[model samples]
Target: MASDAVTIQVPGPHGDRDIRVSSPSRVLWPEQGITKLQLAEYMIAVGDAFVLANGHRPVSLQRFSADIDGEAFFSKNPPKGAPDFIRSVPVVYPSGRSHAQLVIDEPAAAVWAVQMNTITFHPWASRAEDTDNPDQFRIDLDPQPETDFRDAVRIAVELRAVMAEAGLTAFIKTSGGRGVHVFAPIEPVHEFLEVRHAVIAAARELERRMPTEVTTSWWKEERGAKVFVDYNQANRDRTMAGAYSARPLALAPVSTPLEWSELSDADPRDFTVLTVPGRLQSVGDPWEHFADDPGDLSTLLQWWERDLGNGLGELPFPPDFPKMPGEPPRVQPSRAKKP
Candidate 1:
């Protein structure tokens, strides 16, 4: 370790390991006065839960060059000087290209990520071994303009009911912003496209039940004040903030897991890096049993087929993706209408 850096011992699958955190006094979250060492300690405090949610999965690191509010970029590939303990797995991207991405297998690896200046952890829905199939289906409840967290929360409640009808168990989490994320553990029987369709099915159903408050509109102009169900998040290589990952927002709020009962009264600002460690100690991880008894996506797929038969075909994928086979035009709705 350098004279300025601090070495902290972290426990992982391989037991205790010494990890050096450079620039321990450098402020990462400027508003909160959170230092680099404080972020590393936060990872250590929630290490087990963080690993349970993010480990053994290919992840992209959101690294900051200076402070959280400074220059930032995503590091999908392993940067130079990554330790032997840090591992990488090759995963296919939407462009038909393949490359190795970093995977955090234990708590110590996460601390190492903080040392690399990672503020948020973006883990894939699939495990590192089965990179082709997703065992988890994710839905991002993104609140559009004129909408807020409360709107997203209401849509999440409706989504939970939709999942229940399909025999799937749903888990809730904050998006570390003005949105929410809902996940359901599923057997790894379907590929990314199938999972994406399953998410679309769920989102369409929620929209049907609450047309005034929810929407699956591919174009932003049509979304209005509704919460946008970002089904595209299920696409291969796409990721969400890990359950216990910290966000680079003003308060350094964490993307936290929550029991259904707490959603109604929950305030996202309370779940920050400074407070989450103690919250985990007292309340325990709400997603401890999240992977138990993984459900099948058969019911959701059936819904997808039903929607197709009714004339709602494939929606537009992300613009960066190669134009998919049945996807609608990528043009914005207002512009597409122009002659």
Candidate 2:
């Protein structure tokens, strides 16, 4: 091992592998005074849980050149010089084009990602073996201008109840930003569109129950002062930062999972790359039971059909996505009304 890098042998399902971390002292999180080597070590501490949540899935790396706040870009395809141990799986995009995307199957692969200057991990809701059918249902609660984290927490609590009623178990996590993400483990029998509709149904029901606190509005102009349930994130190829993945914030906050009991007082800033390893040691992974019993979306699909009968239909997909069936005109309401 050279003086500038450290070599670690990480045990994986395949075998133990040596990963070299170059420039380990390079400051990745300047504000927190955390170095690239510290980030690599963090992966080893939480590797199992991180792999359990994100491994075997098509993942996109949010990489940086100098530091977390420096020039950043997303890497979907495996980059040049990728190791033989690293693997990729072919997935179809919204445009119907197929491409090979990277898959993280072990802790060593994640450590290698750290070496690649990846600060955040964005894993798909589906595994590599099955890109069309999602085994996880995800919802992103984004706080609008007038609202804040407290508001997002309240909405998350309500969403937990909603998931319970739908016969699904909900897990909560910070977005590594000013929002919350609630996920449910579901059977992979349903495709991405069905999972998306299930999300819409849950969002609409939450809106019905807490009209003042939440909004299902796709248009930002109409979503004032409410936490927008971003159903579009459930679509294929869209991803949220994986749990425990560090963000590009000045503080290098991580997307930490929490038990429902801790959410009320949970602060996203406290879960930084430097602090998370110790926190994990203290509490273990809140999502340790995440895969123990996967639930089916039958009840939620029923809600979807019920909403369809009530004249509520598909919401807008991301603009980049090809115009979907039953999606309303992509133009804004005011603009469309002008013509």
Candidate 1 lDDT at 151 equals 92
TM-score of 2: 0.96
Span of 10 residues, lowest total lDDT, candidate 1 = 1-10
CA displacement after TM-score superposition, residue 262 of candidate 2 (Å): 1.2
lDDT of 1 by residue, 169-244 (tens): 9999999999999998999989999999999999999999999999999788888988999988999989999899
Best by TM-score: 1
- TM-score (all chains, Cα) for each model: 0.98, 0.96
Error of 1 at 51 (Å): 0.4
Candidate 1 segments whose C-alpha is farther than 4 A from its true place: 1-3, 337-339
lDDT of model 1 at position 154? 89
* Model 2 Cα lDDT, one tens digit per residue, 1-339: 224888877777888889988888889877778888889888988999899989999999999988876899999988899999899999999999999999999999999999998989999999999989999989999999989989999999999999999999999999999999999898899999999999999999999999998999889888989999999999989999999898999988899999989999899889888889999999999998897889999999999999999999889989999989999889777667763
lDDT of each structure? 0.93, 0.92
Model 2 spans with C-alpha error above 4 angstroms: 1-3
